[model samples]
Target: MSYDELKSVLVSLGIPEDDISPEASREEVGLDSIAVVELALVLRREKGVDVTEEEIGGTLTVADVAALVGARTPA
Candidate 1:
């Protein structure tokens, strides 16, 4: 999906619109283990996607998370 679409998803996750940049890292934006896991759960429930810590990739920013979600392969 496009970055803009990803940004909206990020915002829905409580991440600010300004924080949805490509330069930010998961940790940089406070994606702690708890939050990450919570997000993974949301992904699963909302999109039927399974995201693992290992599958998080080297994604940095909220935009990166969006890209990751978009990149998720169908089961």
Candidate 2:
């Protein structure tokens, strides 16, 4: 997944578009523990990406999350 695609997913999860950015922290974008789990599920089930909550939780910024997702995503 690209940055824009991850941003879109975050948006779908009820995070404000204005709060999302490459440099934005996950917490700054309202991605708490529950949101992280939901994001993992959404990525796996909806987007066919096999990312885990733990992996998502390890990321600091939105751009980091996007990079992790992109690495795990199928080519």
Candidate 3:
């Protein structure tokens, strides 16, 4: 998925655009547990990627999420 699509998840959650970036950590961008769930749900429904809470919990940055989702794509 594109970085814009990933950023949209944060935008949909009302997070400030300036605070989001591919390199920004989830905590640095104010992504609480609820936001994480919302992100996971969005990725699953909109991007067709199955992400676990534990996976999201362990993420250190937005790029990490992108990589996680990208890596899960079936070949």
Candidate 4:
């Protein structure tokens, strides 16, 4: 998926779309630890993709998170 599409999903989760960018830092996404967990869980259940905490912990950009989800998504 495109980065823009992934960023839009984050935006829909209450994170400002503008706050998301391939270059933006993870902190810029404003997702607290709980929020991160919540998002990972949401992606797993809704998209049939499993994103673990370790993956979330290593993500620094919105694109990274999206990449992780995309990698785990069924083909």
Candidate 5:
């Protein structure tokens, strides 16, 4: 998964670009628990990545999400 694609997913989930940075946590970005769950679903349904809810909850930042998805994505 490309960074842009991940970023787009974040935007679609209601996170603003200004709030999401490589080092910024989801808490810092104002993405609540509900939004994080929805984001996991989006990544699964749209990007074909199978990310668990636990993993989503454990994610620290936008960059972390991207890395997680990227790792699962087929080359």
Candidate 6:
């Protein structure tokens, strides 16, 4: 999952596309606790990425989340 892909997922989750950037914080992009969980489920179920909410929740910025997903994503 690249940064753009993760940003698209965030957009689908109702986050404003303009609010998302590589340096943007998760909270700044409206990624609350519930959103974190939903993102995890969406990634796993829809994108077939095996990421957990805890992992996503631990991230600080959008880049961090993208890196986590990219790391877990198979090439």
Best by lDDT: 2
Candidate 3: worst-modelled 10 consecutive residues by lDDT: 66-75
- TM-score, ranked from best to worst: 2, 6, 5, 4, 3, 1
Off by over 4 Å in 6: none
The backbone clash count of each candidate, in order, is 1, 0, 0, 0, 0, 0
**lDDT of candidate 3 over 1-75, digit per residue (tens):** 667767777788889999998889989888889888887887778778778777988989988877886786444
Give per-residue CA lDDT, model 4, range 1-75, as digits (tens).
Answer: 456666766777889877777777778878778778877777777767767877887888877877877777787
RMSD of each predicted structure = 2.7, 0.6, 1.9, 1.5, 1.2, 0.6
Candidate 4 residue runs with Cα over 4 Å from true position: none
Off by over 4 Å in 5: none
TM-score of 2: 0.97
- Stretches of candidate 2 off by over 4 Å are none
**Candidates' lDDT values, in order?**
0.69, 0.95, 0.80, 0.75, 0.82, 0.94
Error of 6 at 38 (Å): 0.4
Q: State the displacement of the C-alpha of residue 42, model 3, in Å, after optimal TM-score superposition.
A: 1.7
- How much lDDT does candidate 6 score? 0.94
Compose the digit string of candidate 1's lDDT tens values, residues 1-75: 456765565578787777657778887666777767777777777767666765664566766677677777354
lDDT by residue (tens digit), candidate 2, 2-65: 9999999999999999999999999999999999999999999999898999999999999999
- Identify the superior model by TM-score, candidate 2 or candidate 3: 2
Identify the superior model by TM-score, candidate 2 or candidate 4. Answer: 2
Q: What is the TM-score of each candidate against the true structure?
A: 0.68, 0.97, 0.81, 0.83, 0.88, 0.96
> Which pairs of residues have clashing backbones in candidate 2?
none
lDDT of 3: 0.80
